[model samples]
Target: MSFLYFDNNATSRMDDEVLQAMLPYLQETYGNASSVQHKLGRAANTAIERARIDLADRLGSTPKEIYFTSGATESISTVLKGIAQAYNRKGKHIITCKTEHKAVLATCESLGKQGYEITYLDVDAQGNIDLEDLRKAIRADSILVSLMSANNETGVLHPIEKIANICQEKDVLFFCDATQHVGKLPIDLQEVAIDILCLSAHKFHGPKGIGALFIRRKSKPIQIPSLVTGGNQEHGLRGGTYAVPQIVGMGEAVKRFEFHSQIETIRDYFESELQQHIEEATVHARGTLRIPNTSNVLIKHVRSTELMTKVPEMALSSGSACVSGSRDPSHVLKAMGMDDEDVFCSSRFSFSKYTTNDDIDLAIQQIKRAVTQIREASPIWQMYKEGLI
Candidate 1:
């Protein structure tokens, strides 16, 4: 049976071009990028540097500023803990939002045990952080302000430009986990002063286990310790041999994914189709500034888990697949002040450039079928039909 994938936020399907580009490195020219002497090594090293240039050009940054890591988790850990260790004397206080990925939140929690103070900024009803609340939270000893460029579950966007300005004025380092925004959105580091940014290739169309960290350098220099030791790779900031195949694949994926104007139309059509079929569905953060390719909804009287199970051919999810096994509702929805039912009924549907109109239509049909089945069988839904809910 054919399956439809709407879970791009969790991971993307690798493009054929990206796979073809990486095949040679996985077999033929397989040499350590750190080896500078042999021809194969030089070829691999050159390919890695070319990938760096491509990533930097796309992000409007310099090649020297990008550091390759295992993925976004490693990139985030390197930045947050590295900054905490290196700049703890400057300040132990770091401010982040409540809706951030587990990568940021867990890392901050780890640092808290080491005597760092983390302030989690709450989001408004639309999942946007209050600029005034952030400004008020800033202190003379605030060392870093970490936030995500786009929310993983709701696709809500943060005001990073303003936040960047605040951090700059306060002389505090800014870190952004831009896993969902890097390829889908137009990001120009030249325009926004993000001190540190992390993104994963798998979030785009590239292979997994490879990502980049963009660190903006200052004249006085920002000191961050190495997350791993020895071999002195990634400018001695990260250790271990580079995964040449995945890095080359990420570069190839970047070349294929240019932001087009029509992406929002596809998302809008899907939302329109969904609202038409599921009349009582509540689209979360629909009016807020969101990434063009994501749509999150909560169909009343329908349990998302049951809906997903009822349509196994539909590759959709309730929320972030990173925490997929958790039975609890989304923390992101809770932060937006959604009631327990809204949280329980939430479902996330994200798309890629490769996602077609036909795919969206099929997904909509599957969702409608699933919702009808789940709601028809529910005792609560029956009570609501009699005006009891």
Candidate 2:
């Protein structure tokens, strides 16, 4: 049986247009972007610059402000560590939320070991951080605020505009990890004053292993020393030869990006059908705003792993793919006040621009069957049915 893909929050399918655009760079124009001496090198350099301009234009930034990296993880590490090093004189404290991606949380954890103070703000049951808590969290020693625009597991959206405004008023630099939101939703940097932002192309129908970082340079010219230093590439910020094909693919992806509302419709339909058919099914963060492509749901008395095992033909996950191997409950859901059992019962069914209603219908069918099978075999499910604790 063919497997259905519903794990778009982990990574999106690359666009065919992006692939076509990248072919020349990968096959023939392969050269060191730093070495613009030969034709191939110049071609590579020009392609990279063009890609930079395209990405910057999409994000409402200038070409000078954009820097490429291996992916969002590297971008997150570079900014967190570089800022911690460069701005330690100003302050050693950084503020973020508990529901952030592991990229931010792990980097903050590492910073904590280095004597830097890190404040992890709390999220509500709906996976939203209180604005007042954010306001109070900013202190004299607070130099940076790192938050994500969307939760990887629940697809819960942060009020980024308001958060950015608060950071601006408090005179603290704000960094937004927009990896899941960038290509799927609309984000205007000029309207939202985020000082530093990072996005991975793989999250948005571009090639894997390539991403971009946008550091605001117009208003105050935020500065941080290079974390990956070797030679003068990315204006001495990031070093090493650029992946020309990946860069080209990212550019094409950005240029061809369009937010499909149909995915949201299909997602809502999937949730509604599941809830109507499956016993005690619930959608987490359903009351809150989310990216159009994701739906995190739970069917009571059904363990997510067991259900997934029964339905091997469908692509689903309990939480972030980065930590999928861990047996621990999802930290994102746990931070949202879900217990270990509830976390294990929940599954994420993210959609994509390519996802269709028929695909959702088939996934729902498989999920219903698998969930029923898992629940039938579960003693806890039997106990629940018998009204026993």
lDDT of each: 0.89, 0.90
TM-score of each: 0.98, 0.98
Candidate 2 lDDT by residue in tens digits, 186-287: 888889999999999999899999998999886556778888988899889998878899999999999988888888888988888888888899999999
- For residue 20, model 1's alpha carbon misses the true position, in angstroms, by 1.2
Off by over 4 Å in 2: none
- Candidate 2, after superposition: displacement of residue 382 in Å? 1.3
Candidate 1: global Cα-lDDT?
A: 0.89
lDDT of 1 by residue, 1-389 (tens): 56888899999999999999999998999998889899999999999999999999999999999999989999888888888888877889999999999888989999999899999999989999999999999897788899999999989999889999999888788999999998899899999999999999998899999999999978987788998888889889988988999999999988777885566788899999999988698789988899998989988878788888888887778888888899888889999998888898888988888788898888888888888888778899899888987
